[model samples]
Target: MEASSEQPQSVSVHLARLVIFSAVVLGLIVGTLEVTLEYKKLRTTLFEHSEQVAKAFEDIAARAAANRDRSLAEEVATGLLEFKSIASVEVSDETGTVLAWKECGQVEAFGSWLPFEIPSAQHTILLELSTPSSGGEAKGYLKVTASSAQATQIWASQLGMVLISVLFGTALLAGTLLFITHLYVSRPMLRLAEAFRRLDVSDPKNSPLPDPEMFRFREFREIAENGVRLMRDIKRNSEVRDLTANELYRSQKRLQDFAEISSDWFWESDRDGGITYISPSFTKTLNKKTGEVYGRTIAQTTAEPVNTPKWHKLGEIQRQRRQFRDFRYDMAIQPGEVKTVSINGRPFYDEDGTFIGYRGTGADVTNERLIAEARNEALQRAEQASRAKSEFLATMSHEFRTPLNAIIGFSSLLSMPELLKAGVDRVTEYSTAINDSGQHMLALVNDILDISAIEAGKRVLTLEEVEIDGLLSHSLSQIESQAGAKSISLIVEQNAQVGTMVSDERSVRQILLNLLSNAVKFTPSGGEIRVTVDEIGKDIVFRVADNGIGIPSDRLPTIAEPFSHSAIHPHVAKEGTGLGLSIVRSLAVLLDGGFTIESEVGTGTTVTVRLPKNGSGASGEVQTA
Candidate 1:
């Protein structure tokens, strides 16, 4: 089990409590001893001083009696007032009368025991040695008073001494604590932290701390030493374990990223049919694309503690597929097409051989599936085209054969006299028919060759600077001659500001010829076909507009699609191979230009082309036939 961070806090709490409790107890014990000793010493000194004062008063009284002067006792009491501990004294007469005193001079006292009730060495004595002289028998007594003022002085002195001692002791302890903390805790902790920082994650092996036990304090040294050893051992173990773990993580991530971009979704499911890991490629495959459908399994979000039967399937799947890594399967993909998946499932197990889950990836095989499905469709299209070409060739062969057979038979007949006489008109008609059919067949063969070559990417664009006015005029001239035969007007209205531009010269001429031819053929006798040019910012725009029977709106957009044409235009005119506009669009794109067509039913149609203004070098002009 991992240790708790609060474990150290509990130890520290106990240690701190012990330290604080010890300091308090020691302070109390030392303070009590100091105060007690001081009280005893001061009290003893005070009692001795009090005894000396009592003896001095007694001598003063005797001397005063000998001199036969009671007033002399007041003088002696005054003299004793000079002592520092003396509070005050009273000198009194023998009849309990007041005698002379320093504080209360010549006071009267009869018989009072207040004089001897004073503190001694640790006891209080009430009275002793206090009678006046009457010639061996006492008739009158002399009185004395002793002050307890010594007790006050001793208490003051003792309190002051204790204050000084405690202050000095506290200062010394604070300095010691500061030095110990810095030496043991602060500097050593800093060194240990710095050493730990030098360790790298790549090798978490036994890393020793620098100056691990450098703390001079014994406790700090021991802690530092033990902590370093423990950390080093853990680091060594962690390094060994993380090595394989990191490699596995990186490999899984790379595989997942690769699978995400490919055609098919990769999926892994347990034996009881719960998804474990679904690759992001789940949404798209070679044949079709889908959206996010993450409802794979209950464990998709969290790998749970297995308790139920469904969860137990992890073990079952691992037991079955332990030997095989992957297998293929097909799944239903809706809306676009059914997808084929090459799914590979492998069992992942814990150290104890209990299955954790299954992990695998899949690839969509839709393209492979469609190709397999559409084989006959492709075959039919190829076969039909082949048969059409064969039929065309055979028809032409028969057409040519009849002409040849006729011509041969006729020529042979001419060799005889009657056929020779019948030859001129009949032979001329047959010869013309043969020549026309042969020429038509030749044109078809050439068109077929051109289409084939174009489809096969044999054609290359020959770009050069084309003068807008000159190109339009040449194209219009050819169209005008053809339109004149049909009594239609073909006109060129080129604005001079339409500057030169780089383009495929032959392609441009072909585009213009195709547009103009279509216009003239569609226009009626009174209709006009106009070629115009306009400058449009960085590009030059060219338009061929016709006042002819116009195209319907619906068919206008399809004008540029290959193999598309409207039935409305030029019924008697020759039908195009439908590759013209597609070729035009392709050429326009090749020149980095664009084409657009607009028309309204019963109105004229306008076809426009735009090319950028950066003209090709004049020296690179393409010679177009």
Candidate 2:
């Protein structure tokens, strides 16, 4: 399966997560230890300071007691109360009489116990005041109570600040580590992966392996270098495989070419005798010029007498899954045409030895059979051609005389001076009739001469750069008057992309004009004519369509022959020389183009001409005589 295109998490992110998590854990442990130790140290220092203050006031208390002054002792105790941790202090005489006492109300006790009844380190301490005399006995004991609430609060605050610092430091450390990893590891790895992913295996010489020397770490750099080495090896193997595949393809092609050359036709059929594949040469031998005969049974393609003894024997052989060699049979393709072919076929089986199809080669033996009867066929063909020529001459004589007689009769009438004397208008009408007859005769003669020249291979072309849009417009304009007389709307649709083409301008223009004229001439009153010019690939296409009296489908094949007129459009008044399409077809061939016509009687007709955009530089012009 293909990998997702989404950018994935890098090694830097994963490492950052692990390192940041470890830093957070370590910070918590260190912060707890430091806060605990700080709480203990603050408690010890507070007690010691309280003891020292009480001792310093001992001498003052003794003097006060000796002087019998209680007020002075109270002042000493009041001075000690200034300390924040000191809750209260008291001075007593040797008789255990309370002489002075001082209390500080600002101190609030949090507690001596923590959660779960654990004893806290915070506590108060009492100290005694002793005389400096020889007895060194205690004159009065100073009472000191340290609440430790303030000290505990300070510790909590310090711990909070320390925790914040640890968090901030961990975040900064994580970011720094991520940046370093990306620079040294993740980025280089990503580049190597991308380069490998983009490597095209189909082209080994042009596609080089990526360089791994960019990595800073030795281990990763080693990995990249090894990857490059492996890729070089793979590329070498791929080149070898490519060479082998190309050689194999050439061998297969040579065998195919040999088979095609050796036999007149090659074919294959399914186990059910349905044709699967037939070569173009095979179809041409069968007199089928276009389309395919695949998926058809032999009985359907063969003549009506398909149950002959020879075919029966072939069927029996196929039923037994046996190979047949040099099996000759006659195939009647069309009336008056019978072909004899010798075929050699073998049943093809799949890997499991199950019958799949039959592959075969066939040679048309009709020519061999003809050689045996060539003398008889020659005599018959000669007689047939003679008869056909006589009939053609008779028909052509009638066709020529009709137009010649019209011209002669009209010219004779125009030659009379009496018609001119009758009126100038009358003379002008007769002159027009003579001119029309002369044009008809000229068109007939031109068609014959053009066909003869084409058969003699005398056509040549004058190539030029042709403006396609202008040519289409000119052709349509020339046929506009004729279409107007028939009340037919003439339209030209030119693609903007088909601005200009290189072709024989005269032949291209004449081809378009002939098609347009035919559309205008045959279409009924109120019919429509459309001409479209466009460029498709390397070719330029011109299609002329008309809602006219269309030709019969069967007569379409013979429409390109000279003097062949369609009998389907009997209602069309003006008779054509029937050479317009013939001349256009010839011109298309000369220019190395294609021509095709599609028509359905009583419906419409569409004529298409496809010519290469680049005109021929050789002899492509059809010289009309």
Candidate 3:
């Protein structure tokens, strides 16, 4: 059908020949019609002219008839023949006998009556009239003939010239019109259509229309514009369809590779609040299959089964779909024989923020949740035990310290000048022993108090604005003595541009102390530790690097687990509690901060802790060696 729809199977020839042929044909038709009309008009006019002449002749004949004189009739007929248009006049009696006529011999049958019919000629007339008679019998007819062979020749010559003139005029008109129409209308239209017919209609990106600048007609320009618009629309539609198909294919491929990924049942809706699409993942999650819920509502599909809080969780989102916000439902699901899922609803959206649909992942968090619950219970029991244990330890430590204080006071008295004279050596031994024992007992009490507070979760943080230089200087001071014991050198560098980090001053000091001590303990004699303070965005970042034994990569994720110790860190002294790093991690979370470590097996480990700067949102950067 399209093969024939285009400009196909056309015969062409020279312009001259085509115009000549068309002109000849048009000329024949127009000329014939014009000649026919002219003939009819002339014939009708000639008939009217002949009738007037006959009436004049009849008036004369009637006067003669009233006079009842044949000589008068002859004279009147002759007088009536004045018009050259009238060829001759004949007067006849009632019996069809010629009464009087002028030049009766010039016409045939002048005295005899023939059937009085109009004559045909280029210019010829036939007419008759009868006088009204008083008697019932009609007196006679006054027959008038208006014809001249010469006049017929004259009219014929005029008609012949008219026919020739019409032929020439019609030929010129037809030829000129055909040429002008071809130039202005037909030729331009043909060019425009021929260009369109050559377009590649199969490909979406194909250019289908010639440039509209080539079109001279406004109509053709408009046509070309419309074609370009249509092409653009088709191209866009094709792209969208292709993208949708590709997305579906990729999603299916991922599904197959993963071999039964966990399913989540979410009541899906679109920006218009209509259920435009749904997923089969729900059926698999619920230990069911497809077919019962493919085209049904959420109420019909879910295990909730009715107008409980679950079904209505998505109702508001459906109503406000135009706003493009997601509906959140923190609900639980129990797939029979499958693991229980603690689900959180998360919906997806387009760049316009229009709700596309809901898709979220679910994990079996049963073990993690149960462990956390047990930890909470254990923590409560430990707090109750710590109060009793701490009280007894404090009582014992105080009781022991009181006697030691008395011994120290009396021993100091012995060191006075008079007592020193009597027993100086004994006083020195008492002073030294008393001082060491009291300090030892106080240390045991403080350790118990610290552990007790940690278990009870009653430890408070004193957040302060510590400038960068002061913070680094103070932390270095606290750890300089520890590092010096191992013959380790400590270096500190601070950035002047680092604004104050809004952190618990004591806690920050403790975290830094723990990291520095670990570095000092692990480093062989003469090893080095470096502490650096810097500004990242609006946060203060602290990094501590040590050329000490590094942790295994496999233990990185679990290093922050409570009471868990990395094998690398155990190479140092083993007497310390394993809760230092865990305490640091928990405190960091409380302040919305983070800690990280990077290590190589034998080279070194670098730890970075990022804390929020004053008045900045809690975020920063840190890197470890």
Maximum-lDDT candidate: 2
TM-score of decoy 2: 0.41
Candidate 3 C-alpha lDDT tens digits along 388-487: 3454444555556666777667677876787766676877777777776666555445444544465566666555576666766777887778778888
Off by over 4 Å in 1: 1-36, 55-69, 79-84, 91-94, 104-137, 148-151, 154-162, 169-246, 253-265, 270-276, 280-293, 296-332, 335-625
Itemize residue pairs with steric clashes in candidate 2: 460-621, 461-621
TM-score of each: 0.38, 0.41, 0.35
lDDT of 2 at 259: 59
lDDT of each candidate versus the true structure: 0.59, 0.75, 0.61
The Cα error of candidate 1 at residue 545, in Å, is 67
Worst 10 residues of 2 by lDDT: 111-120
Better of 1 and 2 by TM-score: 2
Q: CA RMSD for every model?
A: 18.2, 28.3, 25.5
Cα displacement (angstroms), candidate 3, residue 455, comes to: 30
